[model samples]
Target chain A: MKASYTRLAAVLLMALASVALAADNDNHQVTVTVNDINELAVTGGDITLIISSATAGQNPNQATDNTCGLEWTVNTTNKKITVATNQSSFAHTLKVQAASVSGGTAAAEVTISDTAQDLVTGVATTLGTCTLNYRATATAAQGTQSVAHTITFTITAAS
Target chain B: MKRILPTLAATAAIFLSSLGQAADVAILNGDVSLTITTAAAGQQPPAVTDETGQLEWTTLVTDAVKKIIAQTNLAGPSYTLSVRAVNISAGDGTGAGAVVLSTTPADLVVDIPSGIQPLDPGTCTLRYAASATVTGGAGTDNHSVTFTITDQ
Candidate 1:
């Protein structure tokens, strides 16, 4: 009984000491806001939130630099669009617009590079747009989540 | 340094996954080169009174066709290929009667013949036994037929 009393007294003393030495929690504040806003090409979400085809003044159709999908980039790497299903990021893009075979010989690619990656491997940024229209029968698809060609042109060149 | 937080993160850790992809199906939406041919080979041509209804079908096989070349892509469940004969410029009683064409190893869904199998894709041949009744024309004179085989 004497030994038990001694242990209890020691624990009590330690608890008091810890409370006394505790740092001020008033400065230890936390705030969380949804700022890493990333947009997805949803079906009926934002009308502008789509894989749109550039009109007469879109980016280069036959690009000299490397890119996929209309050469879009993310503002923050913190947030990412999780393709929950069997949605292929590069495979799911709207790229049938690249089927246009005129002006110059053409090629196409859909790539996922490291710079624009959020999930390391899922659907990252455009690694490289398909750049070889050997068969030129192109359609931008995400597994099966895709629409029809959003662009058209007359053919003069062969690729 | 601050710890990251997202209340509406839907799920945990906010990781992303997808149907890890590689686009393989190629949809070449260009003008497909459509070619038509016939299987009636060896040139065992039929003879008639007026003119030889060869490619330049002069005296057509009245009740039958000599041969035809169907130009089409519809494989099966489409229209069956057919070619009939009638003298565009006909005499009083002489005219192209009826013509018939078929694919060898005949099936309704005539698959375009790939040369791997020796069967011809299509054939146009005249059934001499089935004749177009012709009594008297300007003469035992000649004529021609242009058989356009089609799946339309």
Candidate 2:
């Protein structure tokens, strides 16, 4: 009986020792992480647009350079233009009439276009006289977010 | 002795059963972190060509249809502006030349009467081909543009 008791004690001791030598595995979980970021910012200095008034018809007698008309251009031709908003979401405009314009508005049309699409107005671009339309919608680059959006504004007799 | 033997056997059985009880176990824990930084920039022309500039069409008028071609600046946070290029000369009547744009041609729906071709066609009418080489992740660089074109 004493021998049997000794063997049982030995067995219990061996089992207890086995449990103590295990791994300290009390910590392992998946965590979220952030990677790289590229910031694309825009400012007035980054863009260049020149729209002018040129008097064309009434100045028939004047030199061609002195003609009253709309002289405009986009300087940042290297970049692409997006609506940054949606069509009819928000609009920017300027009013030029026979009175404000050197020449009469007998033949005036609103011209709107970019690198891809062209928008035309058959009649003068008066608020009630004609409809001012533009496509406005914008999004930032993939994995990016856009803030402080901007839209375009203009008034010209180009169309 | 037999009763004692059975009692010892019960204890041995209990201990053996307890020893056989092992758990296939896994432990999991983790740490998370987040960071945020921002760098922004803008570029544009202070003012456009408000003053009259010379565009001598003598070089473009090879025929009556070849009048002039030019682009407007692609301004951002865009502003509204009018652009006109007009020059006259006594030339052949069988031909009618005009100014047009690659993006928004002035003569697309051109009117000989008003002479102002509406800005219609594309969003970015003017373009300046450019190229750049970026060195560091955080550094400042600068560039300027001067564009001239003549097309008949």
Among all candidates shown, the one with the greatest DockQ = 2
What lDDT is reached at residue B26 by model 2? 19
> Given candidate 2, what's the lDDT at residue A121?
21
* lDDT, candidate 2, A41-109, per-residue tens: 222222212223334543112111111222122221122112122233222232221112211122232
Off by over 4 Å in 1: A1-159, B1-79, B92-152
Q: Fnat of candidate 1, please?
A: 0.00
Using TM-score, give the best candidate's number: 2
| Decoy 2 TM-score against native | 0.21
lDDT of 2 by residue, B57-147 (tens): 1111121232233333232211222334333322311122322222243331121121112221111122112111111112211211111
Q: Please state the error at residue B16 of candidate 2 in Å.
A: 5.2
For residue B18, give model 2's deviation from the true position in Å: 4.0
Off by over 4 Å in 2: A17-40, A43-46, A56-159, B1-10, B13-16, B27-152
